[model samples]
Target chain A: MSLKNTEAVVLSQLRLGEADRIITFLSPQLGKFKGVVKGGRSLRCKMLASTMPLTQVAVWFVEKRTSGLHLISQCDIINPFRTLKENLHKLVSGLYLTELVEVATWEVEPDEGLFELLLWGLGSLAAGERLQAVLRIFEIRLAVLLGYEPQLSFCLGCEKELAGRESYYFSFAKGGVICAKCRAGARGCKISLGSVNFLRQALRFQQEKLGRLTLTAASSKELQQILPAYLSYHLERKINSLRFLNLLNVRC
Target chain B: MLYTESLAKLVAELKRMPGIGNKSAERLALYILGLPKDEAGKLAQAILQLKERIFYCSRCGNITEVDPCTICQSPARDAGILCVVEWPNDLLAIEKTRGFRGHYHVLMGAISPKTNIGPEALRIKELQARVSSQQVREIILATSPTLEGEATAMYLYEVLKPLGRITHGGRIGVCR
Candidate 1:
């Protein structure tokens, strides 16, 4: 078998026997790969650092003749996300991002655009600026990428353009906005236009420019209500990591 | 035009794994066919050995070849301190840190009303017995930091505190 070299982010790892590990990674070129790293549990193995959750690395592996478990030969760290690890809130958010990517993306299906989006989100989180906003943007963009892009331009069902005065409902089942008229038969949470516009801008902005978008407490609270429902509707399950963030908020 | 009996059986076996579907299972079965004979044999042997040899430790509920497990038998470990975790896997996590020199009590799961898992469903009775009989000073609740985890910790604190001096462990302690 030939050795393939690529850049990847460690999504998760599981112990496989005495000293080896079965690692799940998201590679830019190769999509998701479940590979076996020999002696990964050993202290002398440099791959240990690269195998950490959310660490980006360049990996060299051999596609073995018989099993889907590629044998990792070497790994060089690209970004360790050291700052995210040090800070509790950021670490939880980073883990949430990783969990989302691992769940949403399919194995051996390359989506370069989504990979770039995830990398940018991780980098933004590591940089330690406007984390809440960064996370909101990431969630919106991810939804868009997955083909469930919210219809912010108008009422999702009514085909009428949204105006600043009216409050709209964000529906997970319907996959977008519902105007007051459209809300009669729809099931969702009511959100102000200000918050809707903020979400709209977040979806449109480049990942790096996400920090510039200001979120007031009102908008943030509205987002908290709307986004979770949006995610549960699309992903069909509540994210576990979100609870930790809510707990942290309560503590603070 | 159709798969043989052995190939179909292999696909069915592969599909049993979490998150693997029929298509992926078929892909995996095909991939296994491509491996060198010895390497594939080793993989198959490992699975068989795991199923045959690995059993839950009677005392702590951690996965081990022995009944009481190596940790329970280790003279180096402190019998007075017991770290409570949600799963056998969590026991491995605590052991990996080398920071805790105490014995462990794996609950097998946390109490989740949504999942219909209750205190009686877990190893709580056994844990209480261990605390009383083994002279455990502290019972660290190292469950996941979820709403259910917090509820479980509180329940354990209420139940164990009246019996003895069980410290009220917080989310920060167990998760970090």
Candidate 2:
């Protein structure tokens, strides 16, 4: 069987046999992959460096002509995400992002948008962007890519265009904005337009340009309150890793 | 026209995934067919490799190719301390912290009467044997903060109390 070469991000790794490892990766070209790195568990093996969580690497693997686990022939590290590994808070946030991506995207499906978003998110986290803001943006963008993009332009119920209103409620259940007129009996938290605009920009902005947009302390906090409910509302359950990110005392 | 045997099989497999539904599965199946051959081949290979290469560690029950896993083999780690977890993923969560300096024991699953998974269904007996045979001082029960996890921890506590000290390990402790 011929070996296939590709670039990938190590999403997760598990030991396979005595010396082998089952490496799960998110690749730019191939999407999500789980391959076996022979002798990865041994100290002398160089594959260990490439088969780590969030490590970007160029990899070569052989797929048997028929069908079986691909054998990871070699891997060269691209970026080890040193800052992410060094800081506890950063590491958890990074893991949270990985988990989010794993859950949001389909296995083996080449989602260039989702893959790029993940790479950008990891870079942003490594570059020390505000953790909360990064996560909020990540969630908003993920929702957009997955086709749950919020109707930030208008009241989802009435289709009335929303301006800088005093207060508004985000309907996680309805999957969009609810103007005050429709929020009386809505099943979501009330947020200010400042927070709503921030949410809107998070969805609309390019990753590199995300740095230019800023959130006030209040808007940031309001976003903290809204995004999770918005995600859980659409996803139908709270992401388990999100709790770890929230519980840690890292200021965004 | 689309409700053929192949489409049905694709839907069945897609639906087996954690959160995908029938509609989503159908969409995914169609998407898969639309992909370029190489892309589709890579996807298929990834799934096949995960099942082919990934297996639970015989010693700790964590997913690893090796017998004792990297964490278990590290001489720098404190062998005297063994952190018991409900699943391999929990072991990964603990490992990501790089805080714990010890070994691990994966139970493979928790004791849930509701799920009909009893103590014998888990690696509890192996865990007990490991504690007794090894120079172990503490067993940190790092299970999920759930009903099943709590029950499993309690059961372990009862079984291990006589063997060693039943100390509260902290948030990173033995009991949940």
Candidate 3:
């Protein structure tokens, strides 16, 4: 196997036997992959910050031609995102982003948009942007890229445009907005029409200037419930890190 | 697939064990078959006996054959100072050193958001009860220095702060 290199965002690391660790990372060039970082868990390990989840690192590894764990030789930190870990809420939200990325995509398949989004999301969090807004954008954009994007432009049931400032039902099962007439006994939460419009605009917002668009407390609360529940419905389970994020009282 | 019914059953059973993959389970099953019949019987009996004997201590959540566990019932232990640890293995490590005379409260695990484990799933409630009921004045948080461990310590401090002194006791990492 030849030495391969990629700029990756750390997703998670599980401790292996004693000093070894199995690091899951997402790369712009290589998608998601697990690499064995020898001595990564040791007290003397210098590569600790590089392997920390949510950090960006330039990694060199011996890629196995067969489908097995890669041997990571060197991983240098690109952006540690250390500030994100200082606060409990930010740490869980940052982890939520990586967990979303890890589960949304398959292994060894590159998606440049998702990779860039991951970097931008972590940077926003580390730079002290509001947690709820960053998380909402990250979740929606992730679903869009992964082909589970929730329907917000129009009502899925009535086949009419979702209009005005009234509240509408956003169904996780139906994957879109439901008009009041068609929303009777729907299996989803009632989201404000304003929140739906905001979600749509936020999705189209340029990644570089995401933090500029401030969300109101009400809109943030609505999107926080709608987007995650929808994503969890598609993924067939709750996002584990999100519950912890909620408990730390940093949620929308 | 195995050649015999019993071998197949053995492989299936061994595969259920932690860290035993299908291949490893098969290897272990074959190894067991190669052993003398009495030795194989002894191994099976040992596993059964282990399950019947070992249980979680009700007081601290540590794995023990006794209900309160030896440390909880020990007259030598200083009950006024409690050391809250993340896991039973952590309690064992602390005991191996024989440096601490205080009682322990095993959390079973830390508050790891990535793993969906919050304060609710841990033994923090029992720790709170111990503090309110017992003379737990000086509480030492002996969790790991990992982010999840530190987060757990912080949460514990919040819950126990009103009750007693709270401090962390893990080896210093590269980060403060």
- Which number leads on TM-score? 3
DockQ of each model vs. true complex: 0.05, 0.03, 0.38
In CAPRI terms, model 3 is classed as acceptable
The TM-score between candidate 1 and the true structure equals 0.63
List residue ranges in candidate 2 displaced over 4 A: A64-68, A250-252, B1-176
lDDT of 3 by residue, A1-252 (tens): 999999999999898875799999999989999999899887678787788887889999998878669999999998888788776677778888888888778898999999999998888888875878888888888888978778888888878887785568888888888877888887888889777767887788788777777778998878877888888889887679888777666523
Candidate 1 wrongly placed segments (more than 4 Å): B1-176
Fnat of each prediction? 0.00, 0.00, 0.60
Candidate 1's DockQ? 0.05
For model 2, the DockQ equals: 0.03
Worst 10 residues of 1 chain A by lDDT: A243-252
Error of 1 at A207 (Å): 2.7
lDDT of 1 at A148: 82
Question: Between 1 and 2, whose DockQ is larger?
Answer: 1
lDDT score, candidate 2, position B7 = 81
Query: For each model, chain A TM-score?
Result: 0.94, 0.91, 0.95
lDDT of 1 by residue, A1-252 (tens): 999899998877776866788988898788888899899877677777788767898989998767888999988899987886655567667777877887778888988878888888888899966877778888888888888888888888778898877778888887788988878877888888888888889877776677789887887878876786687678877676676566545544
